[model samples]
Target: MVKGYSNHEEQVFTKIAELRTSNYDSKSINDKIAENQNFSGIIGSLNLTVENYPELKANEEYKRLSENLVIIEDEIALSRKYYNGTIRDYQKFTQMFPNNLLAKLLKSPEFLMFEISENEKENIKI
Candidate 1:
């Protein structure tokens, strides 16, 4: 049962990543990426939970499954942090006074950057 859950989590994570790369640069990509981050976080917590539970850890089969989960969890956490940092830089660029003036003249609207969502703040435990 636990093994099945672990596999499903990995599959979902891979699917979300594939969708993200394929849809990259679209107007809606920002929101989608934010959503992906939340899902990734949830997945990480689940993986960590499996690790902290001693019975699961003692089982050799579960231990093998958990090794992959730990690595993937770290990867997801780093990715989310990187995305947030990139968004911060982009937001700062558009807000600069000189850039704002040029952006207005050039008819370039401000980028709708990714923000950590309210649900993420509330439900996400990572």
Candidate 2:
């Protein structure tokens, strides 16, 4: 068999494969989110790499792939927003006055907001 190129790339891709095969229900939210960040960061780095290559942009295939990646990134961002909104809605339902009493009786699960670690926040621009 032909050997792989970069060990780092292989490891990154392996993590991605694991993410695809693993059951989300079995993972803690933190684990799923860390995977999500790693996936997104890798995709972003690829996009940046493509943008840096004007010769690649000149090729129709590369242009098409870059466009597709951007669309995918946008969709992922939108989906995350929707997911966070859902969590907020659940929190509201469980925390409201009358509903809260019932929620307490039901032992409703606590929901966490979509939050970045302080280190990550420091790296974010605008």
Candidate 3:
């Protein structure tokens, strides 16, 4: 599970770097991030396996890694929330009366929110 999660994280970081270098728009980048089926699948599988084999949770290393994973997941969730909040603020500012006129005149691009897919929200079960 650790190895799989590590590989998934590496792949995701690589993809994000590639997208940034390719000058993909924010919406495209956000969509790509949200559409990571491979990573999600790995996470779901890990969760299911852990649920099925409760003894594995008793292993010291497994317990340590699981705690770390939970911390990392929490951090990621907080970051996503922050990103979405920033996008919301930007959207509101751009759409306000005077700001809307200015944005139109300047042809400002719309900011895209970091969105989670419905599948991503579903809990994993064996």
Candidate 4:
């Protein structure tokens, strides 16, 4: 679980870096979003496993890491909220009046709202 946690952490970081360098085009954004969710799922599994072990859960290092993870989770949630809000505003503008015509002419790509996968909504198998 520790190794998987570390591996996933690296993958999430790498994906974010790639997205930034790739100009955050639709494909890059989507990939980073997928990686973010995948990494969250991996952490969920780790937490589930830890829940069944009282000693490990009580460990100082584990507790500290868990606290940090919670902080990151909060930040990610906020980011998703902001991203979706921006998308809503963008869609409203792009779908209205003369702006719609200009948007169509520019071939602007549509952005999708961040959504959870079915697997993410499922209970993790121990």
Question: For each candidate, what is the lDDT?
Answer: 0.63, 0.65, 0.67, 0.74
Between candidates 3 and 4, the one scoring higher on TM-score is 4
- By lDDT, the best candidate is 4
- Residue 12 C-alpha lDDT in model 1: 65
Off by over 4 Å in 1: 1-27, 41-57, 105-126
Candidate order (lDDT): 4, 3, 2, 1
> What TM-score fits each model?
0.51, 0.65, 0.60, 0.70
- Candidate 2 vs candidate 3: the TM-score winner is 2
Cα RMSDs of all predictions?
Answer: 5.4, 5.2, 5.7, 5.0
lDDT of 4 by residue, 1-126 (tens): 556556655765685566557644655666767766766766786667666666666689987988887788778878999999999999999999999999999998887688877866575433
- Which candidate wins on TM-score? 4
Which lDDT tens digits does candidate 3 get at residues 42-126?
5655666567566666789877977776787678779879977888888899899999999999998765666666876774443
Q: Clash pairs of candidate 3?
A: none
Residue 109 in model 2: shift from native, Å?
1.7
What's the best-to-worst order under TM-score? 4, 2, 3, 1
Q: How accurate is candidate 4 locally (lDDT)?
A: 0.74
Model 3: residue 36 alpha-carbon error in angstroms: 5.6
Query: How many residue pairs clash per model?
Result: 0, 0, 0, 0
What lDDT tens digits, residue by residue, belong to model 1 across residues 1-126? 667656866876786677567645773755666666666566555655665555665788766766776686567567767867877787788679998777678886444444565644453222
Of 2 and 4, the candidate ahead on TM-score is 4
Q: Answer with 1 or 3, whichever has the higher TM-score.
A: 3
